[model samples]
Target chain A: DQQVKQNSPSLSVQEGRISILNCDYTNSMFDYFLWYKKYPAEGPTFLISISSIKDKNEDGRFTVFLNKSAKHLSLHIVPSQPGDSAVYFCAASNGNAGKSTFGDGTTLTVKP
Target chain B: GAGVSQSPSNKVTEKGKDVELRCDPISGHTALYWYRQSLGQGLEFLIYFQGNSAPDKSGLPSDRFSAERTGGSVSTLTIQRTQQEDSAVYLCASSPQPYTANTGELFFGEGSRLTVL
Candidate 1:
């Protein structure tokens, strides 16, 4: 059973546009949510994250919104660039444990 | 090697052979994790270690898979009597204690790819 789910297999966006990636989880105990970006032959790279207590967190061009009631979270990259093209994975974890469950990734391609 | 480091970037072994994967986590990080990724798949948790507490091996696929974290710094994962299904990229990640804060950002290695023939 997949506790975390990224329904969309891929996303495409134009340059300088807003690229949004969505994820959902079935576990209510998960207190931490994170987003990772990966390129070919490389491990995932941390992008952004949000806590259960907060609704929104932003860093530079990237932002993450969490809606606990809906058990959904999204990553938004404003003014998407071609370099932003990659596979994005969402992960959730309980606050105390060392393990984080990951969802099937969404491949994002930002066209220049 | 400021970030997590993994050895044997690529390995090809025949079936029924044993293989060892090593990971060197970032200095001073208290938590380490192992994950597997098959082609076109997401990260699969294999194991993790928190300080001196017993390592969480709940994600191991079977008894053939085992991992050990020595001195809370480096970790090794061993797969015995490996099968063709065990071939995948094994990744290592690390984080500071209280990982929830700071977005729980995990530093990951390039990963070790294993192929069973």
Candidate 2:
């Protein structure tokens, strides 16, 4: 069973537009959620994260919203740029264990 | 290297052969993890190592898959009698904190792509 799921396989948006990616998890034990951005031929890098205690966390142009009631979370990027064109993976862990379950990832293409 | 380092960025082997992939995490980092990504699939957890504590192997897919971290530094993932389905990009990551209040962000290495022919 996939504990974490990202239903959208790919998303496209024009530069300067908002890009939103969604994720869902079935494991209620998960208390920490993270977003990673990956470029072609490279490993994933940490983007942003939020704890269960909070519903929203923002950094620069990236923001993450967590909805514990629905077991859902989302990553929103404002004024998406071409540099943001890459695969984004959503991950979650129960606590400080550091073993995170990841989503299938969504490829975002920002058109110029 | 300043970040996690993985050897043999690409590897090709015949089915039934054993393969070993190595990872060197950032110095002083106590938490290490292994994950694999197959074509059109998500990153699948494999195993985890934290400090001198016992490693977490619950995510190993089969007995043929095993990993070890020696001296709480370098780690090696071994696959015995590999199968074609085992082909994927193996990713290694390390974190500075594993037991305290932290951001839970992982620094990852450029995965090693394994192809079982």
Candidate 3:
């Protein structure tokens, strides 16, 4: 079963616009959420994360909003740049210091 | 310090063969993990290793798949009697602290792409 899900397979947006990516989870035990960006043939880089205690977290141009009641989260990129084009993956940890469940990932394309 | 590093970026082998994939986690990091990603699919949890604790192998698909972490540093994932369905990119990651800390972020390697014919 897919514990985490990213419904959108791909997204396209113009440069300098705001890009929003969404994710959902089925497990309530997950207390931490993270987002990672990956380029072709490269490992995913840590982008930002949010704790279950907090509803939102922001780093530079990236912002993550968490809604516990809905079991959903979102990542927003402001002033999206061409270099921001990559696959974004959402992952969750159940506070066990063990395995993490990852979403299918959303491919973002920024058109300059 | 350098990030996680995985070797043999690409591998192609015939069915029934065995293959070994390697990963070197960041120095001093105590937590390590392995995952697999098939084309157009989500990442699949495979195994996890923490300092001195029993490694979690529950995510492993079958007995043919086994992994070992040597000296609490490097890790090797061995797949025996490989099948074509095994073709996918294998990824490794490490965190400075155990996942329970809730503050550590997972640093990933570029991943090794395996192709089984």
- On TM-score, the candidate that comes out on top is 2
Which candidate's lDDT is highest? 2
Off by over 4 Å in 3: B100-102
Q: Tens-digit lDDT track for model 3 on B1-117?
A: 498999889999999999999999999999999999999887888999998889999999999999999999999999999999999999999987777365447888999999999
Give the native contact fraction of candidate 2: 0.75
**Residue B4 CA error for candidate 2 (Å)?**
0.6
Query: How much lDDT does each candidate structure score?
Result: 0.92, 0.93, 0.91
Clashing pairs for predicted structure model 1, backbone only: none
Which sequence of candidate numbers ranks them by DockQ, best first?
2, 1, 3
Write one digit per residue (lDDT tens) for candidate 2, span B1-117: 699999889999999999999999999999999999999888888998999999989889999999999999999999999999999999999988773355678899999999999
lDDT accuracy of residue B8 in candidate 3: 89
Estimate the TM-score for candidate 3.
0.96
DockQ of 3: 0.64
For B14-114, candidate 1 gives per-residue lDDT tens digits of 99999999999999999899999988888999988989999888899999999999998989999999999999999999988836466688889999999
Tell me which of candidates 1 and 2 scores higher on TM-score.
2
Candidate 1 vs candidate 2: the lDDT winner is 2
Q: If scored against the real structure, what TM-score would every candidate get?
A: 0.96, 0.97, 0.96
